[model samples]
Target: MTDQTPRLEAYQSKRSRTAVWLALGVAVITAGLVGGLLLIPRADRAEPIAVPTAFASPSAAETPAARATEAATRKVTLPAKLLSQPRLTDATLQKLADSMTLQFKDTAPETEDAVSGFYGNLAKQKLTMVIAIDAPVGNPASWASGMTHGLKTSLNAGPFHDVNPGPLGGSAKCADAKASGITIAVCLWADQETYGVLGFYYRTSASVTSDFVKARAAVELPTP
Candidate 1:
């Protein structure tokens, strides 16, 4: 028989071509799938970001409720037993109140509470003051955190201690703060019921804090 090797070779060559075409088709399909994946929208897969905006700030004006609250806070005075003998003079008290009011003008509106307290002479023309706040009946620490939020200068926190009239959770103190450049010292305390602040003043921040520590016993703290 005439050799059929040539026929067989031709058939094998045809099979190779068919195999090549099948492989190419698979590659093309895979490439199309990759291209489709690349074209898919990605925006939906990304997380949305949050942005905060403030429309209007609170007014500096003290509302009638705020004013009444301040009055009540002041009246929640330290008991005579706690008050130092030779109690604060009406004039000195007024001056302290006026000084605190000035501080309040710069700060009161920042807080969600009312302000009250009185001051007396620590020395000639120097003042040691106590200012009480009528804060909500919870979280002294939250109230303390914002003590100097909008103040002219930053406050440095000092040691935390218990108050004499000992508000429920006691009190924490911060000093070396300024309001419109005047030196001030502050303590935040709770009477186990409400929270209040004590402030001391001097010509400079250093002196005011030192005096604040010394005068803590003199100031009348609030009761629950």
Candidate 2:
């Protein structure tokens, strides 16, 4: 019993100090939890991101390969029988020469029909004409259409007018509006029995259709 009271007092003080530390730790943990909850984001504050589609608009210019492919794939309808079957004759050649002189005012149109498949100077305003006689017959309209279409395609040009020449309205024609580089104002006149082609170059200022009409007016073809 000599120091029992002092020992009891010391133990009670130690218990009080431990209780104070425990309460301080509980307060700190509660404050940390509240702070974390306030810092969390809400759904209303967020922005939406836009998603784009895969395909885009095409460019203005087309590729060269595409143009070439388009040209290669183009269709041209030709007659069942070709107009090139006719042979050049001396009588027809004479008629052609007379027509060139009378209509075109080109009297000295040298007939290279035997070698060049045409008459007149190719260097000047020449005519590649042939009368289809004693050969297999074909559609005149179809031949004219094919000829113009071929010219338009090969030359990569336009203004080729489809015409029907002759007073009887039995022939077909295709003439250009004007003449240009490799783009002569040519007119092809084709009837059931005969067909002819007239080409104009830089040397002549005459319309191909006009020349053909004049030549037809001048010459009289024998009935087949």
Candidate 3:
């Protein structure tokens, strides 16, 4: 039993030191594993970003080509009486139509049918002429310009300006010109299938846009 207490104390101290070192080794290994996990790329765990989409514009229904195609399918004819005037006899109308045919022969070679008439008394007379023609006009603006040019050169008319195209939706123009010593309002309208000319004797272009619109509605028979 000699010196047994020192030996027991020394052995207990050694065991305590070994336990402390084991705890430190476990903490270091855990820290290294956590650092390695943090170093991995974040893209694999993050949600994907969303992309945006675009839409297209709508198509128009009242384009010029559409209108022309619709107009080509309809019939064009003038009524027996227009602008509240008595219906002229067929012979008289035919004679006027013949004269128009001759007048427009070179100017409008596409003319297929013609109708002509006079309304009101001599003091306030008006003349209306319409021609149904074969026009394959794709652009209404250019066709209107060319028609105005023909009027200027063939009829010796002045510069023409645009007017209200009316509910029918084509092209209309008017000009003031001297014809037979009278200041006349000359109006012209052209659509896909018809060409019309109106002369308001002793009147100004400023005063006859409404009359031209009315006469156009009367003479051009559009299908429902």
TM-scores vs. true structure, each candidate = 0.39, 0.36, 0.57
User: Which pairs of residues clash in candidate 1, taking residues 3 or more apart in a chain or in different chains?
Assistant: 167-190, 167-191, 167-192, 168-191, 168-192
Off by over 4 Å in 1: 1-75, 78-115, 122-125, 152-168, 179-182, 190-192, 203-224
lDDT (10s digit) by residue, model 1, range 8-50: 8887676455334323432332232223223323331112222
**TM-score winner among the candidates?**
3
Q: Give a tens-digit lDDT track for model 2, residues 179-212.
A: 2233344555544333344444332323455555
Clashes of 2: 0
Regions more than 4 Å wrong, model 3:
1-71, 87-94, 102-107, 123-134, 154-156
State which candidate has the highest lDDT: 3
Which residue pairs overlap in candidate 3's backbone?
Answer: none
Residue-wise lDDT of candidate 3 within 141-173, one digit each (tens)? 555565566445434357899999798777788
User: How close to the true structure is residue 99 of candidate 3, measured as C-alpha lDDT?
Assistant: 54
